[model samples]
Target: MDFLSWYDWITPTNPFASLFFGVIFTVIIGITVWIDTKKLKTTTLAMIVGVFVTIFGVTILNFIGFYN
Candidate 1:
């Protein structure tokens, strides 16, 4: 599929989906910012690893048509 079509297909349209997506991003940002401010090297590293893991897991699920 083309980029636009894929984007349109994946983009959240329902209110719950939008809220969930927003909450996820907000949490990620909040965690990263909090860790940065605290200067906790181990937690920062763990968060980075976790974020990457989550991204890869979501990407795999998307490719497997789980979202559909």
Candidate 2:
């Protein structure tokens, strides 16, 4: 199975679990931003990465038919 299928393991949404993962994801990206001294370059790259990640999340949610 490919990676998108992994969310199937979620089975159901648990508010606390989702919150925990959100914090973890935020922390990781925060650290990456923190370490980069080149403000312009890093900020641009970070924005690109953020947009793509958001699109990817939508794809995953669509694939899983989360709204249905």
- Per-residue lDDT for 1-68 in model 2, tens only? 23223363364243333434544565567567857764767755665676566556655765777644
Q: Lowest summed-lDDT stretch of 10 residues in model 1?
A: 1-10
- For each candidate, give its TM-score against the true structure: 0.46, 0.44
In terms of TM-score, the best-performing candidate is 1
lDDT of 1 by residue, 1-68 (tens): 32233243257433334344545665677577676786666556666666665566556666677656
Give the clash count for each candidate.
0, 0
Residue 43 C-alpha lDDT in model 1: 56
Report the CA-based lDDT of candidate 1 relative to the real structure.
0.56
Q: Using lDDT, give the best candidate's number.
A: 1
Query: Model 2: residues >4 Å from true position, as ranges?
Result: 1-38
